[model samples]
Structures are given as C-alpha cells and as structure tokens.
Target chain A: MSTEELQAWLRRFAELVHEHKDELTALDSAIGDADHGANLDRGMTAVLAALEEAPPADAAALLKKTGATLVSKVGGASGPLYGTLFLRMAGADTFPAALRAGYEGVLARGKAEPGDKTMVDALGPACDALDAGRSVAEAAQAAAEGRDATVPLVARKGRASYLGERSAGHADPGATSTALLLQAAAETLS
Target chain B: MTVGIVVVSHSRALADAAVELARQMLPGRELVVEVAAGTEDGGLGTDAMAVSAAIEAADGGEGTVVLMDLGSAVLSAETALEFLPDDVRERTTLSAAPLVEGLVGAVVVAAGGATREQVAAEAGRGLAPKEAQLR
Candidate 1:
C-alpha cells in the first residue's frame, strides 16, 4: 500500500480499539493487569486529541508522535516496547521495509522471541509473510493465523509470562491486536 | 468540524484494532484519524513515510498533534520532524500521552473541530488515570 493508504489502515485500527475496549480489557484481565483495554483505550483517546491540536506534516512524524505518547502514558512494558516499534518504523521510507523494521525494533526492545507465547509469536510470522511479497490480504491472513497460534504457546514475556504454563490456553491480547492491525492495513490498502 | 487523530502501537494489529474501534465510534463523522503502527515481526516500529504523509494530510487546514506509544517512538518522531515542511511542522504538536485515552478523547474533540488549544488540552487530560474500573 502507498504511505497514504497505510495511514488509513492505522485510522481503521484505532476505530476498532474504541469499539472493543471492553472486550480487550476483559481479555487482559484474565492473564494481565486487567488494564490492557483501558490502557489502550486511554492511550488512543489521547492520540486523537493530540492530532487535533497540531497535525503532523508526514507519516514519520505521526508515528513518532504515537510512540512517544504510548511510552509516556501507558506506564508499562507495552509502553516502551510498542513505543520503540513505532519510533523505529517512523524512520523507514516504505511500507514493507517499515513493517519489517518496526517488527525488528519490537523484538529487539522487548527482548522476546518466537514461540515465547508473546505477541512476537504472531508478529514474527506476519513480518515474514509480508517480506515474502505476500499480498496485504495474504499477509493479514497470516497475521490472524499467527495471532491464533499464540494460544498453545507458553507465555514468556510481559504479564502473560506471569501465568507460566497457565498462560498457554488464552490468546495473547497483544497478538490478537496485532492481527487486527494487519487486517486494517489490508482493508485500507485494498 | 475537522479534527485529526493519530494511533500509535507496537503491534500493527493493535493499532489497526484501535482504528477499527474509532470507525465504529463515529461512523458518520468526517474526522481524520491516522495510525502509526509497529511491525508484526521483530523489526522497527511505524513507517516514517506513513507518519509524514498523515501529518501532511492533517496540515490541510486544521492543525494536528502527534501521539506516540513509547520512547523510541518519541525519538523517531523527533527525527521525522525533518521531513515536514516548516509551516506544517509549526502547526504540529507532539505529546507523550497514554495511547487509548488520548486517542478516544482526541477523536471526540477533533471530530467536533475543536481548536488546537482545545485538542492539546484534551490530549493532556488523557495522561491522567481513568476513573473506570478494569472489569
């Protein structure tokens, strides 16, 4: 997708979060601090406000704004990890390359690996799929599958890790959200 | 009422999810919200080009505020500033607020065409804790 199209994808994703804040919070309650939904909701809300005040001049600035907001407000591992991801991606010039670079930044900053039952499990594969020249639709499908794949793996990072083996049964909230993002990208680009 | 909102997240899915939620919230509103998402796999976060374009789009008439998720995002955003034209950059404001609250609040205000000052005030408000209990 072109950079403009990619921006639409992000807008769509934010809309989804608003719609499902309660559900996401509920899911997070099971294995996390029970604030995932609320936290994300709150964060996005601020993002919307920030945009209204001073709209950025380009895609990189927008993403950078997002990353900083999350880090400063979220107040958890997600804040830093996700923040770094955007910060890095904001530096890239293309969709695919930015996607790959963003993923790598998340991985490096979060210090999580594939199969650790973290969001990485889903994200890792999705990046690979996109890198393989898969269509946005195909890549999004892969991302959904990757999110689902998190169900059986053991949590080794973030709050899910606190559950240990018990975390195996539940889907990672981050991963589920990741899938939704890919879906938005596909929809907007398509 | 022309307002711009930005979504930032580590997971593309998460950012996309937020966007979807926003669409549902104001189905008929002619608001402009943007997403700056991180990669799915282990790579860097958000695309600079995407963020820059979104900012440029927001600069049409109403100004914009850039919201981000974390440290690196803030840093990268600082770097991306170079890509924007002086005028557009002058109209843009960057904040470090909570993602969810900031985004939702901004959507509501921006959709209503709140002034830049009003929007910044709302964005600042998002940094505070929410009163709702986590169910």
Candidate 2:
C-alpha cells in the first residue's frame, strides 16, 4: 500500500472508533470500567489533530507519532497497549512485520497471550493471518472471528481477570477494538 | 537533596489521600512528592502526560522514584519515563512497590536524605512488614 493509503487507514480507523464508541463502551461496561469508548475516542481525536498540526513525513513517522499521542492522551491499560502497537510497527520494513512487531509489543506491555481475552486475542489471530501471506481482508475477517471467539473464554489478564469465570460470555472490549482497527485497515488499504 | 517520590494511581482521590497520609506520617520533612492519577474527566484511569509532569514536579535533583497503584498506573509511569530527558530518565525508577505503604516508606527514606536507590529499595520493601506480621 502507498504511504497515503496508510495515512488514510489511520483516518479511517479513527472514524471507525468514533462510530463504534458506544458499542465498545457497552462491551467494556460488562467487564471493565465502561470508559474504553470514551478513552479511545479522545485519544484518536488527539491523534488526528496532531497529524493535521504537524504532518508526519512518512508512514513510519505517522505511526510513531500516533503511538506517542495515544500514550499521552489515552489513560489506562488500553493507552499503553495500543500505543505500543503503533510504536513497534513504526520500525518495521513491511506491513506483516509491522503487525507482528505491534503484537509483540502488546504482549511485552500487557503480558497477555492468545485466549487471554484481551486485545491480544484479536490482534494475535489477525497477525497470524497476515504472516501466512493472507490478504488484509482475510486478516480482518480472522480478527473479527477472534473477537467473537473471546465471548466464551475467561479473561486471564487486565481488570477483567478480576471477574474470573464471570468474565466469560462477555466480549472483550479491547479485542473488539482491535478487530475494528484491522477491519478499517483492510477496507481502507485494500 | 533527598530523593523525591511520585504516586501514580487510577483515582485522583486515591493518590491525593496517599500523598496526604505520607505527608502526615513524615511531618516536618518537606519532601517533594507529587501525584498523577485519574483521567482528565476524573474517571478511574491514569495518563502518561500527567505522570510525566508529576515526575518533573517531584524531582528535586536527587532523582524521583515513582510508585504505581496498579496495572495501567505502572504502564503510564513507564511511558512517562520515556518522555523524560536522558539524564532525568536515567535517574528515575518505577517501583513495583504497593502504593500506599510504598509511598509512606519512600517518604520516610527520602526525608532522611536517602539516595534514589535507597528510597526505592525501602518503598519496594514496604510490604515486607505486613507480610512478616501476618507470619
């Protein structure tokens, strides 16, 4: 994809987040503090504003700045987790590599793994599809599938873990957001 | 100068109450301590920008040791450290210590003119006393 497409993907992801803010918050309210939507919305707003104020020179710069903006603005675990995703991606040479780096960064920051019912659940499967040389559309589909699968798994990380078995049956808000992000990338980049 | 302490919590009231307790426990010490807790909307969360600013404010040249309340507070504090200048970042330490007890212990150590490492060690050991009492 061209650098312009990458930028558009970011914009489109922001819009997707804005559109799904309430849904995300509702999911979070079931298992979290009910602020995921508002926090992500606020963070993405700052990201777009920063992009407009001082346009990044390249895709890497844009991704890096997006990470920094999220880190500074989005409070709680999502901020650092999502921020680490873009920050790690900024250094990669390929889209797949970038997604892998981003996924690894999330693991390192949150110490979550597949089936943990965190964002890693969706991001991990999406990256796996990408690594298998699948299309972005395929990866996005895998991400959505991963997100749906989390509804039956018990959370083992983050505040949701506090609920133990009770955390089952509720979709992970982070994973849902991750799916939204990948779906946006697939739609905008492809 | 003594080491400074910064408390990062998910609730502004929690950080403030912890700070108030530390100050009361170490009256007359005049230690430089700051709290960075809660989102701008006063929700239960932590902001790295607020954490970074608190660390800067708490620093008194002897370096600052940050105590985080829980999961995201630790992440935010780590992110805040990344924003600091190299020299300041090198001197700052993010303690895995329990927030309330750690802040109190760190305050006492800092008020005694302890170095950053010493204060961090003390703060990290704050839970030891309780653990021992339970034993």
Best by DockQ: 2
Q: What is the lDDT of residue A96 in candidate 2?
A: 88
Report the C-alpha lDDT of model 1 over A1-190, residue by residue, as the tens digit: 3446656776787787778778777767777767666666566666666766887778888888877666545534555556667777888876677878889988876678888766676677778887898887888888888888887877887767777888877778888777777887788875
Q: What is the lDDT of residue A101 in candidate 1?
A: 88
Residues A56-160 of candidate 2: C-alpha lDDT, one tens digit per residue: 898899998999999878886899989989988998878889999999999988888899999998999999999999999999999999999999999898888
> Model 1 chain A, poorest ten-residue lDDT window?
A71-80
**Model 2 Cα lDDT, one tens digit per residue, B31-87:** 888888888878788888788889888887888999988878988888787788888
| lDDT value, residue A32 of candidate 1 | 73
TM-score of each: 0.57, 0.94
Give candidate 1 misplaced runs (Cα > 4 Å).
Answer: A1-3, B1-135
lDDT of 1 at A158: 71
Clashes of 2: 0
* Model 1: DockQ score: 0.03
